[model samples]
Target: MSINIINRSGHPLPAYQTAHAAGMDVYAHLPAEPVTLGPLQRALIPTGLFLEIPEGYEAQVRPRSGLAYRHGIGIVNSPGTIDADYRGELKVLLVNLSDTDFVVQDGERIAQLVVARHERVAWQAAEELSETQRGAGGYGSTGTK
Candidate 1:
């Protein structure tokens, strides 16, 4: 699927890293000096990108697995949603979960963007939902056997 995008970060456009990658790696548009995030700190990292997503579609901003595993860096809102009508710059909410500081360099691959199609559901208010064997079972209801 083709998308309309505007790049003002002076960096290359976001692109898929591999032949069959689902998400396109997004770059961080920061200054020459890096932005340091202390332990438990969070910041908004911009990408200088503006996207015109098609109707019934959205852009999912997700965290980089490598950064999360190596530096404890992750997105504040894992899989942040960008609606089709949005016409602003793409920014990532990054948080440092490790004990040390992590520097965010310019043009760094901080996040991945997956453009997807979604459906709008119509609400059919009813009395209650159907029953199941494990009905109303909250988290961990099914044990790890």
Candidate 2:
């Protein structure tokens, strides 16, 4: 499936690094200067790109595991969604969870974009519902061991 995009970020288009990669690495569109995120601070970093996703599909913005594990940087929303009908710039909300400051350079791989097909649910109100063996069990209802 192909999607339309308008890029003004002066960086290469988002692409999968290897075969069978589900997400495409997205880059920071900052200029020569880098943005610094202080401890516990968050910033909205623009990608300078707009997308046009097809119907019945949505684009998801996710945090990079390497960045989160190495630099303690992650997206404010783990899986930010871009609606299929929405036409707007793609930006990332990054937060620095570590005590030290983290610098985000231009063209740095900040997040990833994954386009997926989704289905809308139709609500059918009813008085009774089917039951299961573990029905209505809250968190940790099943033993850890």
Candidate 3:
């Protein structure tokens, strides 16, 4: 399926792909700029674009594995969710985990956006829920390797 993307700036940005087997496409900026992120600092990086996702689907903002493993820079919210009903600009929230400064150059692939389906839940008020063998077992109660 094809997804429609709107470039608010009225310019075309480069779509990048690191390898042939990659699932998501990396989108670049039309007029790119350098972004400096300090140690343990966070910044909201704009893609200079907006999207019109189909109903019943959502977009997930994630980090690039190469950047996260090599430079220790990753998205704070690992898989940031963008609801289908939202009609706003898409921005990436990145955090620098390295000790030194990290630079984000213009037209660089900083993050990845994956379109996914979300399951809706219907809430109901009830006195009790179904019990299980490990009911209310706090963190790490199962076991450890």
Candidate 4:
């Protein structure tokens, strides 16, 4: 499926791709220097682009595994939900967990976007409902190991 991308700035932005695949597209800023994240620091990094997501679908923002494994830098909200009705700029919230500083280049592939389906449930008031064997048992109640 093709998603519409809008580069609000005059410069060009890169595209998205899977890690196993080479030549994945990435968007970058023109004159701004790369972003550096200090230990225990958090920042909202802008994507320099906007999206026009189609209705009945949502875009999820996720982190790049390489960045997380190598630099201890990852998106605070893994698989962040971007509602279909949201028409604002696409930004990423990154957090640095390592002791050293992490740098984010202008064109770096900081995150990935996945489009998926969502459901909206209707609210109802009921005194009782059907029962199951695991009813009301949560957390580790099922089993261990």
Q: Score every model by TM-score.
A: 0.95, 0.95, 0.82, 0.81
Candidate 3 accuracy as TM-score: 0.82
Candidate 1 least-lDDT 10 residues: 136-145
Candidate 4: where are CA atoms >4 Å away?
Answer: 8-30
Candidate 2 per-residue lDDT over residues 25-86, each given as its tens digit: 99999985889999999999999989999999999999999999999999998799999888
For residues 31-105, what per-residue lDDT tens digits would candidate 4 score against the true structure? 477778999998888777787778878888877778889999778888787887787888888899999998877
Query: Which residue pairs does candidate 1 place in steric collision?
Result: none
Q: Model 1: residues >4 Å from true position, as ranges?
A: none
Best-performing candidate as measured by lDDT: 1
Give the per-residue lDDT of model 3 (tens digit) for 82-134.
Answer: 88777787788889999999987656677877778778889999999899988
Off by over 4 Å in 3: 8-23, 28-32
In model 3, pairs of residues that clash are none
Instruction: Give per-residue lDDT, candidate 4, residue 86.
Output: 84
Listed per candidate, the RMSD to the true structure in angstroms reads 1.2, 1.2, 3.0, 3.3
